[model samples]
Target: MNWTVISDNWLFFLVGAYPYGPLGGLLLTLLLAVGAGILATLLGIGWGLSLTLTSGHIHRLLQSVCEVLRAIPVLLLMFWCFFLLPIVFGIDVPGVLTVIAALALVSGAYLAYAMAAGIAAVPAGQWEAAQASGLSQRQTLRWVVLPQALRIVQPSFVNQWVTLVKDTSLAYIVGVAEFTFVANQVNSREQVYPLEVFGFIALVYLLLCSAVQALGQRLLVKPS
Candidate 1:
């Protein structure tokens, strides 16, 4: 129950040895999550729209690919990105980028499905109304379908983001030195007060996830 461990290493949990060394810890975790989330959103939008817009073989192929990606665990994806890419493709991605790439792929797969569901949930009348107004398919989608679909799935996106933020803890597996890794290092060094050390990190994660949920709620509320 010693609080001094947390007090002493609080800065390390926030940013490990920055200004003197490379940045790590919670800062790196957030960077990876946000970067992956942004990339995932872009991939999700493209894949989601393609799922609805394309048909026959192309759509089926995209669905299979997304399903395969979704089936793979994030840790396995990180291993492939970190280890296999270098051997197979000869592309030596940095550790940070590798984690982000893995996270983006994993989150993007789920987001694509969520988005596709949202698009499907859109009423048939919306498409008909758009076409009746002399809009092309592309125009109709851009003007009518996507907006409503995105709105309907906005909460899902935020939830996905919160999940992604927590997922960044997996980055430590690939030696990314995120918050969990830093805390682990501290715990290893101290070798006492494990409860306080790990408890502090759990609290931090809780706060971070709660903040994200709050932001999502705020964004979901229509301006009065």
Candidate 2:
């Protein structure tokens, strides 16, 4: 519980080498999580919407893809992206990019399922009403169905985002130089109290995650 070491090296743990060099630590972690989550959400929404359409073959294909991705562990996906990608594609992607790819694939699968459920929860009468109002299928989805679906599933969506934030810690295994990685580096160097180092790192994660959950609750409680 050495506050001095923490006070001195806090910046390093928060943004490893960023002020002096490249951006790393919690900042990079959040960047990867937020970017991947946003991309996955958009991709998932598109896939989910397409699933609702009258196309059996396309629905099966997309559903299978989502299932396969969801079945794979994030760590295994990270390994595949880091090691196998270069062998298969002859391209050397950075660790950050590998993490982004893995998270996006995983998050997209879960989001697809969430969004499909949300869309399915919408009443058929709403769809009929939209159609009777002279709205095309696309306009109906955009103006009527999606808005209500999103509202209904917002709490779950925010939960997914929180999961995304926590999952960012896994990026450290691939040498992505995020918050956990920085803390590990510091802990290794300052062996005087390794538990303290890790405890502080845990605290940081708890604080950030709690803040996200608080915000989500506030949003969910707000009157529509």
Best by lDDT: 1
Model 2 TM-score on a 0 to 1 scale: 0.92
Looking at model 2, which ten-residue stretch has the lowest summed lDDT? 215-224
Model 2 alpha-carbon drift over 4 Å, by segment? 19-21, 215-223
Runs of candidate 1 exceeding 4 Å displacement: 220-224
Per-residue CA lDDT of model 1 for 1-224, tens digit only, reads: 78999889889988987868889988988898779988998999889998888999999999999999999999998988888888999999898998898889889989999899989999999999999999999999998888888888888888998999999999877788899999999999999889999899999999999988888777652323
Alpha-carbon RMSD to native, per candidate: 1.7, 2.0
Candidate 2 — which pairs collide? none
| Pairs with steric clashes in candidate 1 | none
Scored by TM-score, the top model is 1
lDDT of candidate 1 vs native? 0.89
